[model samples]
Target: MLRQDLAAIVRAGFSAAAAGRLLERALAPGDALPDGALRVIAAGKASSSMAEAARGLLGSRIRGGLVVSPEPRSVPSPFEAIAGGHPMPTTGSEQAGRRALALAASLQADETLVVLLSGGASALMAVPAAGVALDDKRATTDRLLRAGADIHALNTVRKHLSAIKGGWLAASAPCACRAFAISDVVGDDLSVIASGPTVADSSTFSEAADVLRRFGEEAAYPGAVVARLAKGARGDVPETPKPGDPRLVRAASAVIGGRRDAMDGAAREAGTLGYHVVWIDDPVVGEARIAALLHLRGVVARADGVARPTCIVSSGETTVRVIGDGKGGRNQEFALALAAPLASLGGAAAAASAGTDGIDGPTDAAGAVVDQTTVERARAAGLSPDTFLDHNNAYAFYNNAYAFFAALGDLILTGPTDTNVGDLQIILLA
Candidate 1:
């Protein structure tokens, strides 16, 4: 029940009212647009909710806008909403990217362009650089991701390959551009969020090429992508907008919400549920399975002499190497990895790791949870935890265990929170 309550807390923190509250705060320091002509461009997983909040706040002040999201617009929206691809760009993504550039280019000196950015915008808006085909760009991005390159390396490559990313979109506007982002990355890097369309980029073309080479996949990328990077490195093409560029003088941005907010929400719910909340301040990082092992060792030792029931909570994203042909995201893997160690606790304790956005990788479920009995229950159902972990098929294990795992926190399946803030983990112990 605590696990289910944690899911509800995540939903509440996903923020309809909280988004408005944030926008109201974000508007305080910015200069007003006297022309009453506000143009809003929202992109990524939380694009629709953020756009709606902006509309509610700006009202008649907003003259026009665009929303690029992974899902189709539900209709009756004031902005030109396009259903864009995520994790990969589609034709709709290309259309949205082109229109975004045109929209920024059309802005006058007195007008304002508000960019609502979040996670997935990098793929949701992909306008390749000159001479680079979208397919080539897509292929390159896929290779980088599959290589398990970190976000810094990923965005370095992404910014260099695209025309709209890395502050180019903001530079195109003659008017003031302000961005409000729901950060989904650790450390809330402004330049990494949505590839920083409204923030100056410090990455160089040479650095982008280095990322591909560092991952040993430089030659694996499509030819056009490889050629473009080489050209930029050789000074044949211009670099992304750098800091202090005159064009970006009027551009500014802020992180409105993120994983920290979700983390705090979980802590609050735990406290309300009558447990002493203990926070795991360090961000969850590295391979999902390894991280799970470390957490188990640390927390289980700490639970030895607790006088009160406790809720241990932490947040951050972890990566998966994906060596096998299995179906699972990092969160699912994290939770599944805990089953073995958690059984050692020998109490009514449960732990869960889930994406705040409620979608894990390519699967329909958000993530999974495991208790002391999870391993025993799964084995009774004719499953092998080690075998699943070996194949990296955490999702399949959880799915196959569904019949026997009912109400044991098997999944946290909150569909489309319309927000992204990384992932969360909660462990309740007595």
Candidate 2:
């Protein structure tokens, strides 16, 4: 019963149709565009759905556009769709970047460019700056991700090394540009979402360099990236646009969907299921393992004196420092880390952590669900949860742990949710 409630909550929180409705309301008829030809350029997981919402409102006004996504989807419009890489940029990502730039540049003073931005745009629309190779940029991103750098820190450096990010795309166009974003960042800082392709970036090269050094990743970053950042920090290169930059005069950005929306949705679903909803006010961040422990403690605290079933929900993106060369994303690692504590609850509780985007780490599973019985079941199946946690192999552990989780329908799998609002964690106490 708890598993079913969790699944319902996840589904309600990540419904593409619901996301579209929110977008449509936010972009009431003719609000996003003016009386001119519209060229839409959408990027990230929610690109296609967001674009479709625009199409529903502004039919033939969308002359031509492009949508860059991590997977293929049928776009019922004239926009060209391209599959780009995510988590890391690839050659296709470079090509998509060029295409988006070209589309932005093609806009005349009388036309409007509508950019739909989302979580993975930094990678899906990758254009390395001059003298910086794509491989170098890719390597830098990979290293920072493995180092457990947050999105803000990762994009701070990326904004300095890219051609399209940090308001460059907006500066390149001659006409007015408006960006609609579905934020996946903790604070919903427009400049950090998808690296702020159309918004002014307040981060500087010196700060980017500081982030690398602070994270102990400077030595491991690609040589070209390091040199470029150093040169920029020394003021040898121009900085990204700051607040009130003239180049961003005609560009406006607003977030249409975010973590709060997902949280509300989950809360409503839990309430409908007759569970007392306990909203966790703190945003989930920092190390995955630590976040898991903190969340577990919160659940235990909320479980006290509860006469009815209760659901606790929190939302935010967490980081995973790759200590072991294991295969799991932050969500999976978080779930794995909770095994011991959940076991201590003795079947009275269950929790799930998963990326709303339908992918976790590099694995196919979205995330895992664990209860008090999980550790015992694993032990009975000759598996050790501690060993997997040490190896950071949550995906493998969940997949091979006697199929108990699978048989219970605990593994949350929703393919490429077509939207992202960071990660959602749900804990049910009975």
Candidate 3:
């Protein structure tokens, strides 16, 4: 019997949301000096929500501000909200970028600047550098994403080509900037948060060029972008401000949430469900399939060693090298791969993988869950897990079992959750 506990599923789905709430709780009015004259500026996937949180803390004292974020513009925030394109820069994103830069440039020395940053900020809050067009930036971003470039590499190139990223916004603002960030990348490197608009950058132009060349995407990127890097590498264009630079002297940054937060909550919930909890690690980044394979091997080993009910918990962003035109994200891909390996073990325990953010890759569902019987069920339905895994079509495979696997409510969902820490995977070896 494939017993589905709707409440448990909902609990798992809401765990990430609970983590997001915890992040917002860490922000206090005392964190930022209540000078009644701070100019708020934020950008990223969660920038809007973070801005809203700050606004609630600041109340009517805010001296006006601007936020650049993905569109289908969020509800009227206390401050001005400007929606922009994401994963790729568009004309609207360019306009929002200008507005953000203008807002930063207008800040006075006496005015404190509050910056809210999160993932997706790089593409959403894009401001093209000199001689770079929006179309060119979009094309370059598309190429990098398709080539399976990791987040760090993609953002490195993005920062160098942007007018606002790589600490330009901080440099533009004369006011002392205080950054409140939601970290999405592993290690929580500030430079990776929305490409580090308010924080100092350590990446060099030559490194940016190297990433493109290594990915075989050098030719796909704009010639102008490449030329600019070459010039910057030769010292014509100034490097980004490093740590301890005078510009960063008055700046402040804090990470309120991350992958571990989600993972911890999920582990707790699994324990409550009568499973022996096993916490792996949070923010486990790398190739999705390999991670899945390793996880399966561990689960199989553990299952063989004990008769006690057990569950394994892990969190991290995984990458999928798109070899074909397929529809799926890392979490989905991971789940599909796990199903293949778990099929060899055979049993009734269920394993579910999900993105803490709810939306995994371009798919609507957060991820998928499969039991030992799922493979035979899939085979009976004429669905070949191995065949689809090769094509990166996990979404399609799960869609066929939507009644079961896809019913898992997403932790990442609509409405601003005010956070982005990455994915969380849980395997209940009952």
Candidate 4:
């Protein structure tokens, strides 16, 4: 019963519908565009939902626009939605990027541009900078990701190498521009969300270069990618717009939802279920497995004076360094890391970690659930959690190889919440 309840609570907080409702309210008409029509561009995993919200509020006032999404679909008659690559950019992504830039450039001085952004947009709307090949950019992106670069660091490199990121999109338009976002990063920094296409960037090419160097990936990146950063850092190429740039004076941005919303939603649902809630606000970061160990220690310590039926909630994004050839995301790795430790503790508890977007890595399942008996079950089923974990094969541990989690009905499979606010974890103790 607690396992089912745990999944339900996580769902209540990470609901795409709830996130969509927030977007609809944020898109409410503030004022009419005097003397001109309005144009819009929505990007990221939440692209279609955001575009739909804007259409409901603005109607014919919107002239036409593009929605760069991770999936293909039809929005309204005037708006076109194209499936772009995620975690990597594809030809469709390039088309979206160019179309987005052209759309922004078409805005007249009296007209306005409304940019809707969310997670995955950085890759979906990627337009390589001058002389930078899309293939090279893709290779660099893959390298940084596998090297475990955080969102801030990853976006820093992306901003400098992109034609439409790091305030470049906003700078290209002379008309007044406003951006609304659903953040999937820590602190909800507007400039980091979707690499801040419509928000001014303070990060520099130098920082981007440093990120590559820090990860020991500088030399391995494509020569053009390397040369572009070198040129941008050396001022041979123009840098992305910085803070207080005149070109960005016409643009404004806001973050409407993020990890905090996921946490708050979980807390509310846990309370309604008659559990005393304990929230750990410190963000979970760093290596996925290590973060899980740290999180487990914190939860166990909190159980000291707490009442029974306690729900411990926290949400943050983490990175997974792909050392082993395996299939799983950070959240899956995170959940797998907890199995042995919690089994050793032997308590009446159930823990679940999942992405709000209903995806973890390349897997169809959002995440997985683990209980004290998880390790025991696996051992009896001729499986080893540590072996699966060491190979970064958490998905196999949960689904494919033995399908232990599937057998227990603990694998979380909520398809495409279409909202990105990082990941949520719930530990219910009774």
Please tell me which model should have the higher lDDT, number 3 or number 4.
Answer: 4
By descending lDDT, how would the candidates be arranged? 4, 2, 1, 3
Tens digits of per-residue lDDT for model 3 on 1-430? 2235323642464455443264467665365463648887777666666666766666676878877777655634457877877667778788878888888789878888887777677877778888788887888888888778888999898888888888888878877888767777888788887788888899999999898898885667789888888888899887877787897777777776776767666767766777777767535577888888877776566556554577677777888888866875787788777776666665556666765555677776666666667777778878888777788877777776556544543122333444567766777665
Tens-place lDDT digits, model 2, residues 1-430: 7777888888887773245666797788545667888999999988888888888888898999998999876787698998889889988899999999999998899999999888798999999998999999898888888878899999999999999999999999999998889989999899999999899888999999998898775778888888999999899999998889898899999998898888888999999999998888689888888889987887678667865688888889888887876885789889878878977875577888989888998977677787778777878888897887777777778787535667876567777887888999888888
**CA lDDT for candidate 4:** 0.86
Evaluate all candidate structures by whole-model CA lDDT and list the values in order. 0.82, 0.85, 0.72, 0.86
Summarize candidate 1's per-residue lDDT along 1-430 as a digit string, tens digits. 6556655555544442244455556665545333447888999888887788778777887878899999898632469988889888988899999999999999878898989887899999989889988888788877776666777788999998899999999999999988988888888999998889999999999999989898776668888888988999999999999999999998888898877787787777677778787778778887899989898788766656765677777888887777788875888899889988888876777888888777888888888888888888889889998898887899988888676665565877778777788888888886
- Model 1 segments more than 4 A misplaced: 1-21, 28-35, 75-77, 300-306, 406-409
- Give the TM-score of each candidate: 0.94, 0.96, 0.90, 0.96
What TM-score, to 2 decimals, does candidate 3 have? 0.90
Tell me model 1's lDDT, rounded to 2 decimals. Answer: 0.82
Native-to-model Cα distance after best TM-score fit, residue 50 in candidate 4, in Å: 0.7
Q: After superposition, how far is residue 408 of candidate 3 from its true place, in Å?
A: 8.8
